[model samples]
Target: MIPTKEEWIKVLNEKHGEDVQKKLSAATVAICGLGGLGSNIAVSLTRAGIGKLILIDFDRVDISNLQRQQYRMDQIGEYKTSALSENLTLINPYTELCVHTVRVTEDNMEELLREADIVCEAFDKAEAKAMLTNYVLENMPDKYLVAGSGMAGFDSANLVKTRRVTKRFYLCGDGVSDVNDNIGLVSSRVMLCAAHEAHAIIRIIAGKYEI
Candidate 1:
Protein backbone atom coordinates (compact mmCIF):
# COMPACT_ATOMS: atom_id res chain seq x y z
CA MET A 1 0.00 0.00 0.00
CA ILE A 2 1.13 3.54 -0.65
CA PRO A 3 2.02 5.66 2.33
CA THR A 4 0.60 9.11 2.79
CA LYS A 5 2.96 12.11 2.95
CA GLU A 6 2.91 12.30 6.74
CA GLU A 7 3.22 8.53 7.13
CA TRP A 8 6.11 8.46 4.71
CA ILE A 9 7.89 11.17 6.65
CA LYS A 10 7.42 9.32 9.91
CA VAL A 11 8.70 6.08 8.43
CA LEU A 12 11.73 7.72 6.85
CA ASN A 13 12.56 9.64 10.01
CA GLU A 14 12.39 6.47 12.06
CA LYS A 15 14.46 4.50 9.60
CA HIS A 16 17.15 7.11 8.97
CA GLY A 17 17.03 8.88 12.30
CA GLU A 18 15.83 12.43 12.64
CA ASP A 19 19.15 14.15 12.00
CA VAL A 20 20.05 12.25 8.83
CA GLN A 21 16.50 12.60 7.53
CA LYS A 22 16.72 16.33 8.04
CA LYS A 23 19.90 16.53 6.00
CA LEU A 24 18.43 14.46 3.22
CA SER A 25 15.21 16.44 3.33
CA ALA A 26 17.08 19.63 2.56
CA ALA A 27 19.32 18.35 -0.24
CA THR A 28 18.99 18.93 -3.98
CA VAL A 29 20.56 16.39 -6.28
CA ALA A 30 20.73 16.56 -10.07
CA ILE A 31 20.73 13.24 -11.90
CA CYS A 32 22.02 13.53 -15.47
CA GLY A 33 20.74 10.32 -17.00
CA LEU A 34 17.93 7.83 -16.60
CA GLY A 35 19.46 4.59 -17.69
CA GLY A 36 20.62 1.85 -15.35
CA LEU A 37 22.50 4.12 -13.03
CA GLY A 38 20.45 7.30 -13.01
CA SER A 39 17.12 5.52 -12.83
CA ASN A 40 18.16 3.41 -9.87
CA ILE A 41 19.88 6.32 -8.17
CA ALA A 42 16.77 8.46 -8.43
CA VAL A 43 14.65 5.79 -6.77
CA SER A 44 17.12 5.24 -3.96
CA LEU A 45 17.43 8.96 -3.28
CA THR A 46 13.69 9.39 -3.17
CA ARG A 47 13.29 6.47 -0.75
CA ALA A 48 15.95 8.12 1.39
CA GLY A 49 13.81 11.24 1.57
CA ILE A 50 15.79 13.71 -0.52
CA GLY A 51 13.99 17.02 -0.76
CA LYS A 52 14.51 18.00 -4.39
CA LEU A 53 15.60 16.16 -7.48
CA ILE A 54 16.44 17.48 -10.93
CA LEU A 55 16.06 14.62 -13.38
CA ILE A 56 17.46 15.21 -16.90
CA ASP A 57 17.10 12.77 -19.72
CA PHE A 58 16.03 13.19 -23.32
CA ASP A 59 15.59 9.52 -24.17
CA ARG A 60 12.43 7.51 -23.94
CA VAL A 61 12.07 4.27 -22.07
CA ASP A 62 12.68 1.21 -24.21
CA ILE A 63 11.97 -2.49 -23.90
CA SER A 64 15.65 -3.24 -23.16
CA ASN A 65 15.70 -0.73 -20.32
CA LEU A 66 13.26 -2.87 -18.36
CA GLN A 67 16.09 -5.31 -17.61
CA ARG A 68 17.91 -2.84 -15.40
CA GLN A 69 16.36 0.64 -15.41
CA GLN A 70 13.63 1.72 -13.01
CA TYR A 71 10.82 1.65 -15.54
CA ARG A 72 7.90 -0.72 -15.94
CA MET A 73 7.03 -2.38 -19.23
CA ASP A 74 3.98 -0.17 -19.42
CA GLN A 75 6.24 2.86 -19.34
CA ILE A 76 8.12 1.94 -22.50
CA GLY A 77 8.29 4.72 -25.11
CA GLU A 78 7.53 7.46 -22.59
CA TYR A 79 10.23 10.01 -21.89
CA LYS A 80 12.47 8.76 -19.06
CA THR A 81 12.02 11.97 -17.11
CA SER A 82 8.25 11.56 -17.15
CA ALA A 83 8.30 7.85 -16.34
CA LEU A 84 10.74 8.23 -13.45
CA SER A 85 8.86 11.19 -12.01
CA GLU A 86 5.72 9.12 -11.64
CA ASN A 87 7.56 6.28 -9.91
CA LEU A 88 9.58 8.54 -7.61
CA THR A 89 6.58 10.54 -6.50
CA LEU A 90 4.86 7.33 -5.52
CA ILE A 91 7.73 6.57 -3.17
CA ASN A 92 7.89 9.97 -1.54
CA PRO A 93 4.88 12.15 -2.05
CA TYR A 94 6.50 15.15 -0.35
CA THR A 95 9.64 15.09 -2.46
CA GLU A 96 9.93 17.67 -5.18
CA LEU A 97 11.09 16.51 -8.61
CA CYS A 98 12.15 18.88 -11.38
CA VAL A 99 12.30 17.14 -14.72
CA HIS A 100 14.17 18.37 -17.79
CA THR A 101 13.65 16.20 -20.83
CA VAL A 102 16.69 17.45 -22.69
CA ARG A 103 20.15 16.25 -23.54
CA VAL A 104 23.12 17.42 -21.55
CA THR A 105 26.02 19.13 -23.26
CA GLU A 106 29.05 21.10 -22.19
CA ASP A 107 27.30 24.26 -23.34
CA ASN A 108 24.40 23.58 -20.96
CA MET A 109 26.28 22.05 -18.06
CA GLU A 110 26.29 25.13 -15.89
CA GLU A 111 22.61 25.86 -16.41
CA LEU A 112 21.66 22.27 -15.66
CA LEU A 113 23.72 21.65 -12.56
CA ARG A 114 24.23 25.06 -10.98
CA GLU A 115 21.64 24.60 -8.24
CA ALA A 116 22.55 21.05 -7.33
CA ASP A 117 24.42 20.31 -4.15
CA ILE A 118 25.58 17.06 -5.69
CA VAL A 119 25.69 16.02 -9.34
CA CYS A 120 25.09 12.34 -10.06
CA GLU A 121 26.44 11.26 -13.47
CA ALA A 122 24.96 8.17 -15.06
CA PHE A 123 25.62 8.51 -18.79
CA ASP A 124 26.27 5.28 -20.72
CA LYS A 125 29.16 6.43 -22.93
CA ALA A 126 32.70 6.86 -21.67
CA GLU A 127 33.26 10.11 -23.55
CA ALA A 128 29.96 11.45 -22.26
CA LYS A 129 31.03 10.66 -18.72
CA ALA A 130 34.38 12.34 -19.27
CA MET A 131 32.71 15.36 -20.83
CA LEU A 132 30.37 15.90 -17.88
CA THR A 133 33.07 15.13 -15.35
CA ASN A 134 35.36 17.76 -16.82
CA TYR A 135 32.54 20.24 -17.17
CA VAL A 136 31.46 19.81 -13.55
CA LEU A 137 35.00 20.07 -12.24
CA GLU A 138 35.73 23.19 -14.24
CA ASN A 139 32.43 25.03 -14.06
CA MET A 140 30.60 23.76 -11.01
CA PRO A 141 33.78 23.58 -8.99
CA ASP A 142 32.08 23.33 -5.63
CA LYS A 143 29.56 20.67 -6.58
CA TYR A 144 30.54 17.14 -5.67
CA LEU A 145 30.23 14.83 -8.67
CA VAL A 146 29.46 11.16 -8.11
CA ALA A 147 29.94 9.07 -11.27
CA GLY A 148 30.03 5.38 -12.11
CA SER A 149 32.78 3.74 -14.13
CA GLY A 150 32.98 -0.07 -13.91
CA MET A 151 29.82 -1.89 -12.94
CA ALA A 152 29.22 -4.25 -15.81
CA GLY A 153 28.33 -7.88 -16.41
CA PHE A 154 27.87 -10.30 -13.52
CA ASP A 155 31.28 -9.78 -12.00
CA SER A 156 31.63 -10.18 -8.25
CA ALA A 157 29.75 -7.45 -6.49
CA ASN A 158 32.74 -7.03 -4.18
CA LEU A 159 34.74 -5.77 -7.14
CA VAL A 160 32.42 -2.77 -7.36
CA LYS A 161 33.67 0.00 -5.12
CA THR A 162 33.78 3.75 -4.81
CA ARG A 163 36.91 5.82 -5.36
CA ARG A 164 37.52 9.44 -4.64
CA VAL A 165 39.13 11.00 -7.70
CA THR A 166 39.64 14.41 -6.14
CA LYS A 167 38.26 16.56 -3.38
CA ARG A 168 35.22 17.28 -5.54
CA PHE A 169 34.95 14.14 -7.66
CA TYR A 170 34.19 10.50 -6.86
CA LEU A 171 33.83 7.45 -9.10
CA CYS A 172 31.80 4.36 -8.23
CA GLY A 173 31.88 0.79 -9.53
CA ASP A 174 34.59 -1.79 -10.09
CA GLY A 175 36.56 1.09 -11.59
CA VAL A 176 37.78 -1.33 -14.26
CA SER A 177 34.77 -3.18 -15.68
CA ASP A 178 32.69 -2.10 -18.65
CA VAL A 179 29.82 -3.48 -20.69
CA ASN A 180 31.12 -5.08 -23.86
CA ASP A 181 30.69 -8.09 -26.10
CA ASN A 182 31.21 -10.51 -23.25
CA ILE A 183 30.25 -8.38 -20.27
CA GLY A 184 26.67 -7.23 -19.98
CA LEU A 185 24.62 -5.28 -17.48
CA VAL A 186 22.23 -6.81 -14.98
CA SER A 187 20.03 -5.10 -12.42
CA SER A 188 22.09 -6.22 -9.41
CA ARG A 189 25.47 -4.91 -10.58
CA VAL A 190 24.05 -1.70 -11.96
CA MET A 191 22.07 -1.02 -8.81
CA LEU A 192 25.22 -1.57 -6.74
CA CYS A 193 26.92 1.32 -8.48
CA ALA A 194 23.77 3.39 -8.32
CA ALA A 195 23.60 2.83 -4.57
CA HIS A 196 27.17 4.00 -4.26
CA GLU A 197 26.40 7.18 -6.15
CA ALA A 198 23.25 7.76 -4.08
CA HIS A 199 24.99 7.18 -0.77
CA ALA A 200 27.85 9.45 -1.79
CA ILE A 201 25.34 12.21 -2.38
CA ILE A 202 23.82 11.63 1.04
CA ARG A 203 27.18 11.71 2.75
CA ILE A 204 28.13 14.93 1.03
CA ILE A 205 24.87 16.57 2.04
CA ALA A 206 25.19 15.45 5.64
CA GLY A 207 28.69 16.94 5.80
CA LYS A 208 30.08 13.50 6.59
CA TYR A 209 32.03 12.84 3.41
CA GLU A 210 35.61 11.93 4.18
CA ILE A 211 38.64 11.58 1.94
Candidate 2:
Protein backbone atom coordinates (compact mmCIF):
# COMPACT_ATOMS: atom_id res chain seq x y z
CA MET A 1 0.00 0.00 0.00
CA ILE A 2 1.42 3.39 -0.92
CA PRO A 3 1.11 5.82 1.92
CA THR A 4 -0.01 9.39 1.31
CA LYS A 5 2.67 12.09 1.45
CA GLU A 6 1.24 13.51 4.68
CA GLU A 7 1.18 10.04 6.18
CA TRP A 8 4.83 9.56 5.32
CA ILE A 9 5.73 12.94 6.77
CA LYS A 10 3.85 12.15 9.97
CA VAL A 11 5.69 8.85 10.32
CA LEU A 12 9.05 10.50 9.78
CA ASN A 13 8.34 13.25 12.30
CA GLU A 14 7.20 10.72 14.90
CA LYS A 15 10.26 8.57 14.38
CA HIS A 16 12.88 11.32 14.16
CA GLY A 17 11.26 14.03 16.28
CA GLU A 18 10.06 17.24 14.65
CA ASP A 19 13.36 19.12 14.97
CA VAL A 20 15.58 16.41 13.48
CA GLN A 21 13.08 15.80 10.71
CA LYS A 22 13.09 19.48 9.87
CA LYS A 23 16.86 19.55 9.71
CA LEU A 24 16.89 16.53 7.47
CA SER A 25 14.22 18.02 5.26
CA ALA A 26 16.27 21.19 4.82
CA ALA A 27 19.55 19.55 3.87
CA THR A 28 20.77 18.74 0.37
CA VAL A 29 23.27 15.94 -0.12
CA ALA A 30 25.36 15.35 -3.24
CA ILE A 31 26.44 11.75 -3.84
CA CYS A 32 29.34 11.26 -6.27
CA GLY A 33 28.71 7.67 -7.41
CA LEU A 34 25.63 5.48 -7.69
CA GLY A 35 27.06 2.04 -7.10
CA GLY A 36 26.63 -0.16 -4.02
CA LEU A 37 27.44 2.49 -1.43
CA GLY A 38 25.70 5.46 -3.06
CA SER A 39 22.53 3.54 -3.85
CA ASN A 40 22.08 2.34 -0.28
CA ILE A 41 23.00 5.67 1.20
CA ALA A 42 20.53 7.45 -1.07
CA VAL A 43 17.69 5.18 0.03
CA SER A 44 18.54 5.69 3.68
CA LEU A 45 18.66 9.46 3.44
CA THR A 46 15.46 9.57 1.43
CA ARG A 47 13.68 7.47 4.05
CA ALA A 48 15.09 9.83 6.68
CA GLY A 49 13.31 12.75 4.95
CA ILE A 50 16.23 14.47 3.28
CA GLY A 51 14.94 17.38 1.21
CA LYS A 52 17.08 16.94 -1.89
CA LEU A 53 19.65 14.63 -3.42
CA ILE A 54 22.16 15.24 -6.23
CA LEU A 55 23.23 11.98 -7.86
CA ILE A 56 26.00 11.66 -10.51
CA ASP A 57 26.90 8.54 -12.42
CA PHE A 58 27.83 7.50 -15.93
CA ASP A 59 27.09 3.81 -15.67
CA ARG A 60 23.99 1.75 -16.17
CA VAL A 61 22.60 -1.04 -14.04
CA ASP A 62 24.01 -4.41 -15.05
CA ILE A 63 23.32 -7.97 -13.99
CA SER A 64 26.53 -8.07 -11.96
CA ASN A 65 25.33 -5.03 -10.01
CA LEU A 66 22.41 -7.02 -8.55
CA GLN A 67 24.63 -8.50 -5.89
CA ARG A 68 24.95 -5.25 -3.94
CA GLN A 69 23.23 -2.40 -5.76
CA GLN A 70 19.70 -1.37 -4.89
CA TYR A 71 18.51 -1.78 -8.47
CA ARG A 72 15.95 -4.42 -9.45
CA MET A 73 16.20 -6.84 -12.38
CA ASP A 74 13.80 -4.80 -14.45
CA GLN A 75 16.12 -1.78 -14.13
CA ILE A 76 18.90 -3.57 -15.97
CA GLY A 77 20.35 -1.42 -18.81
CA GLU A 78 18.92 1.73 -17.22
CA TYR A 79 21.25 4.46 -16.09
CA LYS A 80 22.06 4.25 -12.41
CA THR A 81 20.88 7.81 -11.80
CA SER A 82 17.50 7.15 -13.42
CA ALA A 83 16.98 3.84 -11.62
CA LEU A 84 17.91 5.32 -8.26
CA SER A 85 15.73 8.39 -8.78
CA GLU A 86 12.74 6.18 -9.56
CA ASN A 87 13.31 4.12 -6.44
CA LEU A 88 13.87 7.18 -4.26
CA THR A 89 10.62 8.76 -5.40
CA LEU A 90 8.78 5.62 -4.37
CA ILE A 91 10.31 5.97 -0.91
CA ASN A 92 9.51 9.68 -0.64
CA PRO A 93 7.61 11.38 -3.38
CA TYR A 94 8.13 14.82 -1.86
CA THR A 95 11.87 14.57 -2.13
CA GLU A 96 13.75 16.52 -4.81
CA LEU A 97 16.41 14.91 -6.98
CA CYS A 98 19.03 16.31 -9.37
CA VAL A 99 20.79 13.75 -11.55
CA HIS A 100 23.86 14.14 -13.73
CA THR A 101 24.39 11.48 -16.37
CA VAL A 102 28.02 12.42 -16.91
CA ARG A 103 31.16 11.26 -15.18
CA VAL A 104 32.48 13.66 -12.52
CA THR A 105 35.60 15.45 -13.59
CA GLU A 106 37.92 18.06 -12.08
CA ASP A 107 36.51 20.66 -14.44
CA ASN A 108 32.91 20.08 -13.46
CA MET A 109 33.16 18.90 -9.87
CA GLU A 110 32.82 22.26 -8.17
CA GLU A 111 29.89 23.43 -10.29
CA LEU A 112 28.14 20.09 -9.77
CA LEU A 113 28.49 20.09 -5.99
CA ARG A 114 28.47 23.77 -5.02
CA GLU A 115 24.92 23.86 -3.70
CA ALA A 116 24.97 20.75 -1.59
CA ASP A 117 25.09 20.92 2.18
CA ILE A 118 26.92 17.62 2.37
CA VAL A 119 29.00 15.73 -0.21
CA CYS A 120 29.11 11.94 -0.07
CA GLU A 121 31.92 9.92 -1.68
CA ALA A 122 30.42 6.64 -2.90
CA PHE A 123 32.60 5.69 -5.86
CA ASP A 124 33.85 2.10 -6.13
CA LYS A 125 37.26 3.03 -7.50
CA ALA A 126 39.98 4.01 -5.05
CA GLU A 127 41.36 6.68 -7.35
CA ALA A 128 37.94 8.21 -7.88
CA LYS A 129 37.39 8.33 -4.15
CA ALA A 130 40.72 10.01 -3.54
CA MET A 131 40.20 12.49 -6.34
CA LEU A 132 36.75 13.56 -5.15
CA THR A 133 37.95 13.75 -1.56
CA ASN A 134 40.84 16.02 -2.50
CA TYR A 135 38.76 18.24 -4.75
CA VAL A 136 35.97 18.77 -2.20
CA LEU A 137 38.35 19.46 0.63
CA GLU A 138 40.44 21.85 -1.41
CA ASN A 139 37.79 23.74 -3.35
CA MET A 140 34.66 23.44 -1.26
CA PRO A 141 36.20 23.73 2.14
CA ASP A 142 32.94 24.71 3.78
CA LYS A 143 30.92 21.72 2.67
CA TYR A 144 30.83 18.64 4.85
CA LEU A 145 32.11 15.52 3.11
CA VAL A 146 31.13 12.00 4.14
CA ALA A 147 33.18 9.33 2.39
CA GLY A 148 33.73 5.56 2.62
CA SER A 149 36.77 3.42 1.95
CA GLY A 150 37.90 -0.19 2.50
CA MET A 151 34.43 -1.71 2.52
CA ALA A 152 34.71 -5.02 0.69
CA GLY A 153 34.06 -8.68 1.35
CA PHE A 154 31.99 -10.27 4.13
CA ASP A 155 34.58 -10.69 6.78
CA SER A 156 33.30 -8.54 9.66
CA ALA A 157 30.38 -6.09 9.87
CA ASN A 158 31.93 -4.25 12.81
CA LEU A 159 34.93 -3.43 10.68
CA VAL A 160 32.80 -0.81 8.97
CA LYS A 161 33.12 2.35 11.00
CA THR A 162 32.84 6.14 10.82
CA ARG A 163 35.32 8.82 11.84
CA ARG A 164 35.52 12.59 11.60
CA VAL A 165 38.61 13.30 9.52
CA THR A 166 38.33 17.08 9.91
CA LYS A 167 35.80 19.69 10.86
CA ARG A 168 34.23 19.34 7.44
CA PHE A 169 35.27 15.82 6.48
CA TYR A 170 33.95 12.46 7.73
CA LEU A 171 35.20 9.04 6.66
CA CYS A 172 33.38 5.72 6.89
CA GLY A 173 34.33 2.08 6.31
CA ASP A 174 37.15 -0.26 7.42
CA GLY A 175 39.80 2.12 5.97
CA VAL A 176 41.78 -0.85 4.67
CA SER A 177 39.52 -3.30 2.86
CA ASP A 178 39.38 -3.36 -0.94
CA VAL A 179 37.83 -5.51 -3.65
CA ASN A 180 40.38 -7.84 -5.14
CA ASP A 181 40.85 -11.43 -6.18
CA ASN A 182 39.15 -13.75 -3.66
CA ILE A 183 37.66 -10.70 -1.95
CA GLY A 184 34.59 -8.92 -3.25
CA LEU A 185 31.92 -6.58 -2.05
CA VAL A 186 28.90 -8.23 -0.49
CA SER A 187 25.65 -6.41 0.22
CA SER A 188 25.93 -6.74 3.99
CA ARG A 189 29.28 -5.06 4.48
CA VAL A 190 28.70 -2.55 1.73
CA MET A 191 25.38 -1.50 3.25
CA LEU A 192 27.02 -1.31 6.67
CA CYS A 193 29.53 1.23 5.38
CA ALA A 194 26.80 3.04 3.47
CA ALA A 195 24.78 3.28 6.66
CA HIS A 196 27.70 4.89 8.40
CA GLU A 197 27.96 7.51 5.64
CA ALA A 198 24.21 8.14 5.81
CA HIS A 199 24.30 8.46 9.58
CA ALA A 200 27.22 10.82 9.39
CA ILE A 201 25.26 13.05 7.06
CA ILE A 202 22.33 13.02 9.45
CA ARG A 203 24.56 13.82 12.40
CA ILE A 204 26.18 16.74 10.64
CA ILE A 205 22.84 18.15 9.62
CA ALA A 206 21.19 17.46 12.99
CA GLY A 207 24.06 18.91 15.01
CA LYS A 208 24.77 15.51 16.59
CA TYR A 209 28.42 15.38 15.59
CA GLU A 210 31.27 16.62 17.78
CA ILE A 211 33.57 17.46 14.89
Candidate 3:
Protein backbone atom coordinates (compact mmCIF):
# COMPACT_ATOMS: atom_id res chain seq x y z
CA MET A 1 0.00 0.00 0.00
CA ILE A 2 1.19 3.51 -0.74
CA PRO A 3 1.95 5.53 2.36
CA THR A 4 0.29 8.87 2.86
CA LYS A 5 2.28 12.08 2.68
CA GLU A 6 2.52 12.08 6.47
CA GLU A 7 4.09 8.66 6.50
CA TRP A 8 6.48 9.73 3.83
CA ILE A 9 7.35 12.75 5.87
CA LYS A 10 7.99 10.62 8.94
CA VAL A 11 10.32 8.32 7.04
CA LEU A 12 12.18 11.25 5.58
CA ASN A 13 12.32 13.04 8.89
CA GLU A 14 13.96 10.07 10.51
CA LYS A 15 17.02 10.75 8.40
CA HIS A 16 16.58 14.51 7.93
CA GLY A 17 14.75 17.24 9.75
CA GLU A 18 11.64 19.11 8.66
CA ASP A 19 13.57 21.91 6.98
CA VAL A 20 15.44 19.71 4.51
CA GLN A 21 12.35 17.73 3.67
CA LYS A 22 10.36 20.88 3.16
CA LYS A 23 12.94 22.27 0.82
CA LEU A 24 13.09 19.08 -1.22
CA SER A 25 9.32 18.79 -1.44
CA ALA A 26 8.58 22.39 -2.38
CA ALA A 27 11.00 23.16 -5.22
CA THR A 28 10.37 22.70 -8.92
CA VAL A 29 13.51 22.02 -10.93
CA ALA A 30 13.98 21.80 -14.67
CA ILE A 31 16.74 19.56 -15.90
CA CYS A 32 17.97 20.02 -19.48
CA GLY A 33 20.03 17.63 -21.65
CA LEU A 34 18.96 14.36 -19.95
CA GLY A 35 22.42 13.03 -20.76
CA GLY A 36 25.23 11.99 -18.50
CA LEU A 37 24.97 14.78 -15.96
CA GLY A 38 21.25 15.52 -16.13
CA SER A 39 20.27 11.86 -16.03
CA ASN A 40 22.06 11.03 -12.81
CA ILE A 41 21.01 14.31 -11.22
CA ALA A 42 17.40 13.60 -12.06
CA VAL A 43 17.61 10.23 -10.42
CA SER A 44 19.11 11.74 -7.30
CA LEU A 45 16.48 14.47 -7.13
CA THR A 46 13.60 12.08 -7.59
CA ARG A 47 14.85 9.81 -4.84
CA ALA A 48 15.45 12.83 -2.62
CA GLY A 49 11.76 13.86 -2.69
CA ILE A 50 11.83 16.83 -5.04
CA GLY A 51 8.14 17.65 -5.34
CA LYS A 52 8.33 18.24 -9.06
CA LEU A 53 10.78 17.70 -11.86
CA ILE A 54 10.69 19.27 -15.32
CA LEU A 55 12.73 17.16 -17.70
CA ILE A 56 13.57 18.67 -21.09
CA ASP A 57 15.63 17.14 -23.85
CA PHE A 58 15.10 16.27 -27.52
CA ASP A 59 17.77 13.67 -27.85
CA ARG A 60 17.19 9.94 -28.05
CA VAL A 61 19.16 7.33 -26.18
CA ASP A 62 22.13 5.78 -27.94
CA ILE A 63 24.42 2.92 -27.09
CA SER A 64 26.99 5.43 -25.89
CA ASN A 65 24.62 7.14 -23.48
CA LEU A 66 23.72 3.88 -21.77
CA GLN A 67 27.16 3.70 -20.17
CA ARG A 68 26.77 6.86 -18.12
CA GLN A 69 23.15 7.90 -18.59
CA GLN A 70 20.53 6.66 -16.13
CA TYR A 71 18.94 4.45 -18.74
CA ARG A 72 18.69 0.83 -19.57
CA MET A 73 19.43 -0.89 -22.85
CA ASP A 74 15.73 -1.16 -23.51
CA GLN A 75 15.52 2.62 -23.55
CA ILE A 76 17.66 2.97 -26.66
CA GLY A 77 16.23 5.35 -29.28
CA GLU A 78 13.67 6.69 -26.77
CA TYR A 79 13.34 10.36 -26.00
CA LYS A 80 15.40 11.03 -22.86
CA THR A 81 12.86 13.07 -20.91
CA SER A 82 10.19 10.45 -21.43
CA ALA A 83 12.47 7.66 -20.38
CA LEU A 84 13.55 9.50 -17.27
CA SER A 85 10.03 10.60 -16.38
CA GLU A 86 8.82 7.04 -16.49
CA ASN A 87 11.71 5.93 -14.33
CA LEU A 88 11.11 8.76 -11.87
CA THR A 89 7.48 7.81 -11.50
CA LEU A 90 8.60 4.39 -10.42
CA ILE A 91 11.10 5.87 -8.00
CA ASN A 92 8.80 8.44 -6.43
CA PRO A 93 5.22 8.14 -7.44
CA TYR A 94 4.40 11.11 -5.24
CA THR A 95 6.57 13.48 -7.27
CA GLU A 96 4.98 15.62 -9.95
CA LEU A 97 6.72 15.74 -13.32
CA CYS A 98 6.67 17.62 -16.62
CA VAL A 99 8.40 16.29 -19.69
CA HIS A 100 9.52 18.34 -22.69
CA THR A 101 11.10 16.86 -25.79
CA VAL A 102 11.99 20.26 -27.21
CA ARG A 103 15.42 21.75 -26.87
CA VAL A 104 15.93 25.00 -24.90
CA THR A 105 16.84 28.02 -27.01
CA GLU A 106 16.57 31.79 -27.01
CA ASP A 107 13.15 31.77 -28.64
CA ASN A 108 11.72 29.20 -26.22
CA MET A 109 13.78 29.88 -23.15
CA GLU A 110 11.29 32.04 -21.33
CA GLU A 111 8.37 29.76 -21.96
CA LEU A 112 10.23 26.62 -21.04
CA LEU A 113 11.72 28.03 -17.87
CA ARG A 114 8.92 30.26 -16.67
CA GLU A 115 7.72 27.82 -14.01
CA ALA A 116 11.03 26.25 -13.08
CA ASP A 117 12.39 27.07 -9.64
CA ILE A 118 15.88 26.41 -10.95
CA VAL A 119 17.38 25.19 -14.21
CA CYS A 120 20.11 22.60 -14.72
CA GLU A 121 22.06 23.13 -17.93
CA ALA A 122 23.61 19.74 -18.69
CA PHE A 123 24.14 20.10 -22.41
CA ASP A 124 27.69 19.64 -23.68
CA LYS A 125 27.48 22.17 -26.48
CA ALA A 126 29.34 25.36 -25.71
CA GLU A 127 27.10 27.45 -27.94
CA ALA A 128 23.96 26.11 -26.29
CA LYS A 129 25.30 26.71 -22.78
CA ALA A 130 26.30 30.27 -23.69
CA MET A 131 22.91 30.97 -25.20
CA LEU A 132 21.11 29.53 -22.17
CA THR A 133 23.28 31.56 -19.81
CA ASN A 134 22.37 34.70 -21.71
CA TYR A 135 18.72 33.75 -21.85
CA VAL A 136 18.46 33.10 -18.10
CA LEU A 137 20.47 36.18 -17.26
CA GLU A 138 18.17 38.27 -19.40
CA ASN A 139 14.74 36.74 -18.91
CA MET A 140 15.03 34.58 -15.83
CA PRO A 141 17.45 36.70 -13.89
CA ASP A 142 16.52 35.24 -10.52
CA LYS A 143 16.98 31.65 -11.60
CA TYR A 144 20.19 29.71 -12.12
CA LEU A 145 21.82 26.85 -13.99
CA VAL A 146 24.35 24.44 -12.46
CA ALA A 147 26.43 24.14 -15.60
CA GLY A 148 29.40 21.96 -16.48
CA SER A 149 32.69 23.01 -18.03
CA GLY A 150 36.20 21.61 -18.51
CA MET A 151 34.94 18.03 -18.52
CA ALA A 152 36.17 16.97 -21.89
CA GLY A 153 38.81 14.44 -20.96
CA PHE A 154 38.43 11.22 -19.01
CA ASP A 155 41.88 11.84 -17.56
CA SER A 156 40.88 15.22 -16.12
CA ALA A 157 38.85 13.50 -13.44
CA ASN A 158 38.24 14.84 -9.95
CA LEU A 159 34.82 15.39 -8.46
CA VAL A 160 35.62 17.00 -5.09
CA LYS A 161 37.62 19.87 -6.61
CA THR A 162 34.71 21.27 -8.64
CA ARG A 163 33.76 24.88 -7.96
CA ARG A 164 30.64 27.00 -8.11
CA VAL A 165 30.65 30.20 -10.15
CA THR A 166 27.94 32.34 -8.59
CA LYS A 167 25.69 31.36 -5.75
CA ARG A 168 23.30 29.87 -8.26
CA PHE A 169 25.43 28.76 -11.20
CA TYR A 170 28.38 26.40 -10.88
CA LEU A 171 31.19 24.94 -12.98
CA CYS A 172 31.77 21.38 -11.87
CA GLY A 173 34.50 19.04 -13.08
CA ASP A 174 38.05 20.18 -13.75
CA GLY A 175 38.17 23.94 -14.27
CA VAL A 176 41.69 23.93 -15.64
CA SER A 177 42.67 24.18 -19.30
CA ASP A 178 43.72 20.56 -19.31
CA VAL A 179 40.23 19.57 -20.39
CA ASN A 180 40.72 18.58 -24.00
CA ASP A 181 38.98 20.78 -26.54
CA ASN A 182 37.99 17.78 -28.63
CA ILE A 183 38.48 14.59 -26.67
CA GLY A 184 35.34 12.80 -25.52
CA LEU A 185 34.91 11.86 -21.86
CA VAL A 186 34.39 8.38 -20.52
CA SER A 187 31.80 7.14 -18.03
CA SER A 188 33.88 7.74 -14.89
CA ARG A 189 34.44 11.45 -15.46
CA VAL A 190 30.98 12.04 -16.84
CA MET A 191 29.37 10.47 -13.77
CA LEU A 192 31.69 12.48 -11.54
CA CYS A 193 30.49 15.71 -13.08
CA ALA A 194 26.93 14.48 -12.84
CA ALA A 195 27.31 13.82 -9.09
CA HIS A 196 28.71 17.29 -8.39
CA GLU A 197 26.10 18.86 -10.58
CA ALA A 198 23.47 16.96 -8.64
CA HIS A 199 24.89 18.14 -5.32
CA ALA A 200 24.95 21.76 -6.43
CA ILE A 201 21.44 21.44 -7.77
CA ILE A 202 20.25 20.02 -4.45
CA ARG A 203 21.88 22.85 -2.53
CA ILE A 204 20.40 25.45 -4.85
CA ILE A 205 16.92 23.98 -4.72
CA ALA A 206 17.10 23.74 -0.95
CA GLY A 207 17.71 27.51 -0.83
CA LYS A 208 20.97 27.04 1.01
CA TYR A 209 22.52 29.31 -1.60
CA GLU A 210 20.73 31.88 -3.73
CA ILE A 211 21.58 32.78 -7.27
The prediction achieving the highest TM-score against the true structure is 2
List pairs with backbone clashes in candidate 1. none
Ten residues in a row with the worst lDDT in model 3?
Answer: 175-184
Model 2 off-target regions past 4 Å? none
TM-score of each: 0.95, 0.96, 0.88
- Candidate 1, residues 105-155: lDDT per residue as tens digits? 988888988889999999999889999999888877778999999888888
lDDT of 2: 0.92
TM-score of 1: 0.95
Model 3 regions lying over 4 Å from their true place: 1-5, 176-182
Model 2 earns a TM-score of: 0.96
